[model samples]
Target chain A: MGFSISVEGGQGEATIKLVGELDAAAAPQFKEAIEKLAVDKPQRLILHMDQLEFMASAGLRVLIFARQKMGADVSLYVIGSRGPVLNTLKMSGFHHSVYLQDTYAPE
Target chain B: MDKLTLPAVLASLAELRRYAREAAAAAGIEEERSYQLQLAVDEIATNIISYGYKDAGPMAQIVIGGEITADVLIITLEDHAPAFDPRTRQMPDDDELSKPLEERTIGGLGIYLAMEGVDRFDYRREGERNLNIFEMRRRNG
Candidate 1:
């Protein structure tokens, strides 16, 4: 299947849930969400990707874009990414740019 | 061994994936070697579409072939793009990943990862086309 994204507010942060395959086809939608979040300028951004099964290099590019659009002061969290999706991040060395956790803890 | 041409778009990734899987299986590639070959092909094919031929026109085509000899999987990809050797590109430094996205470089990491994933990688500029050959053997072998 293709990909989908859902953004919601949680406590003091904004959480974006990504589902399905994140590839070149899904990058535009992903980019739009990050741009919208940049307007709100949340203190933290949490990406829930437990259901994300795959990620292409284009998807990784969007993740990099999100990191830049959100700015350095904003904390970015990626939760529950596994399998090929997580390997893409680890292989590209993106696992270091964001905080990765099995579960998001409300602070 | 099989060959097919699809538009060099992100939409074509599924086609590439299937090609890699079927080709590896037909070659009787081991599980670990199959996975590594798949990853390497994905990275290279994606790079070809994204960077090698970023323009719109006759979509760049990929020729994939594989064989198993003595428990080793040998896959080769031939494409008509500029003479760019992915292997010669430098890998990202340990600290490069932590930098801000804007400060970080965009390309090169995929090629680096592909190199690391396979047991052997070789590239050559064959006349008008770029030829890349990758090999992977059973880890315990």
Candidate 2:
């Protein structure tokens, strides 16, 4: 499957839901979404990735871009990532950089 | 063994991954290992298309072939773009991987995962072709 991304937000929180395969071809779109979200400077960024079946190094680069773009003060949460998507995050130790949860339970 | 040749472009990655996954399954590779193999192939193939074929012109092609031996499943990626060896790419060290988000660099993560995900990864250059070999040990059940 090709990649698709959507953003939902209100106030200080924003959630980006990513679906389908995220390869080099789709990384730019994701990076663009992050760029748009960074403009608002939300306090919290949540990535919903349950349906994101595959993620390559390109996707990882964008995750880094999103984190840096969001800055250190913002909290980033990754929810429902599984299979190869979860494996990529865990293998690259990216799971440590963000809050990983089965569901979005904001503190 | 089944071999396929496709344009060395980003769009061909999905079909390449599907080919790898199906080959792994036919070779009796488990689900997790199959995904790893797929990732490994995608990473190297991406590098080949993105870097190797950067200025090699429009007709550049990436050839992917799968071989199932008695004990191992091997997938080979060949490209005529350049003789770049993915193993030579510097991977992120432990210290680098543990760094804070803002301080970390994303370079080499793909090659790192590609090498680490598979049981064995090898690279070689034959004449003008760059061959990346990814291998996984078949289960003995």
Candidate 3:
């Protein structure tokens, strides 16, 4: 019903936690968060979408925007995306472009 | 058939999605297919509000309705916007989809996903209205 975004960045890694639905109305908020990350251009961008219930194309657009804005050198990871959110990404063929994981565990 | 009319604006999209979801449920659709139905409706509704009636304001409206057939569910979205059919949009082919993010353009992705998500999609112009029809076959357990 509602959307919220929280970001944390340090050590060349930035993590964003997304909750609720990511529809057209919430796309701007996600884009804004990505814009801020663009400034840092962190080596890794990990998106925590375990709590995300839905995602429309607008949300996918922002993900595309985030990848382009952050540059190709940055590794984008989508963590815990399931159900509709995962379906949207896969349907758009976006899942091929990102690292999808159930958890953000680095070895 | 059940229908809900909403102002053709971004804010009205949430309500329209809700209507689509409920209609899918009424037709005995499961969660995954229901979500696909919702996405299909949301994409075209967005195109209508964002492009069709760019400056039409609150006077412009979108009508969303659905009907349940014996083996299929049909959801329709009607708007008084331009005659542009979403089916005409250039969809991203496999080569384009396989390209890296930096090489890709965001245009037409929504339409591609919308059309792909539904079992059947049709566009029709009925006088002053543009109707987008989405159909999904009901699977029996």
Candidate 4:
């Protein structure tokens, strides 16, 4: 329906699972989550986006926000983003800002 | 072609997307292509609604309509805001995109992504209305 963000993992790693549509209306919740997560200073911030149904430019802006908030050293990963969500990332060239993978195995 | 009149606001985006989905499906557009169509429309609508006018008052109304023919898909957005042309924007140059995150600009990517998969995108001014036309060749073509 809307958007939900859940943070998992611990120590230097955290997985933020995003579900539902990520449009302009839903972006605030996402940004709030990112703001909260940034305080943890996780070395690896994994965005698990397999269930992310749609992503508009607003959502893309949040991805940029996360990069700037987390700084240059935090290695960010976008996992399993498909359909419009993936296409939006690729089309806007935001795909370059994160490591995209079919799956992420926590070590 | 089915039509929807959306208030220019972020709150209207979900319903705008719903209308886009129904229009695309009724036109026999498949899921993938429909997504592209929706993305293209969303980007434009967001721009017109978010920036075209500065008012919490009666927002500008954006009318969107679409038709898919045997060989092509055409989407039209009619807005009564100040005349602006989206096609005049060039795709973000390599240098802009290549800029480091902290150095990159905040805006401009939305309109750039709007034209990504479409075959031809045109903009025109008719009296007080700005008509944006988005066309794409069907995959089978």
Best by TM-score: 2
lDDT of 2 at B18: 93
DockQ for model 1 equals 0.50
For each of the candidates, the C-alpha root-mean-square deviation to the true structure, in angstroms, is 2.7, 1.3, 1.5, 2.3
- Model 1 interface Cα RMSD in Å: 2.6
Candidate 2 TM-score, true structure as reference = 0.96
In the range B20-135, model 2's lDDT, one tens digit per residue, is 99998999999888988998899899888888889878898999999999999999999997678887889999888877778888889999999988989998889978889999
- At residue A47, give the lDDT of candidate 2: 94
Query: Each candidate's chain A: what TM-score?
Result: 0.91, 0.94, 0.94, 0.90
Per-candidate interface DockQ score: 0.50, 0.80, 0.77, 0.60
How far residue B41's Cα lies from its native spot in candidate 2, in Å, is 0.4
Candidate 2 ranges beyond 4 A from true positions: none
Off by over 4 Å in 3: none
Candidate 1: pairs in clash: none
* lDDT by residue for model 4 (B1-141), tens: 768887777777777777767877776777887787777787888888877765536856888888878877788889888888987766577787876665667677878877775678899999999998888776635
Q: How many residue pairs clash in each candidate?
A: 0, 0, 0, 0
Ranking by lDDT: 2, 3, 4, 1
Q: Judge the docking of candidate 2 as incorrect, acceptable, medium or high.
A: high
Candidate 1 local Cα displacement, residue B95, angstroms: 3.3
Candidate 1 Cα outliers beyond 4 Å, as residue runs: A9-11, B27-33, B98-102, B139-141
How does model 3 fare in lDDT? 0.87
DockQ, candidate no. 2? 0.80
Docking class of 1: medium
lDDT of 4 at B31: 85
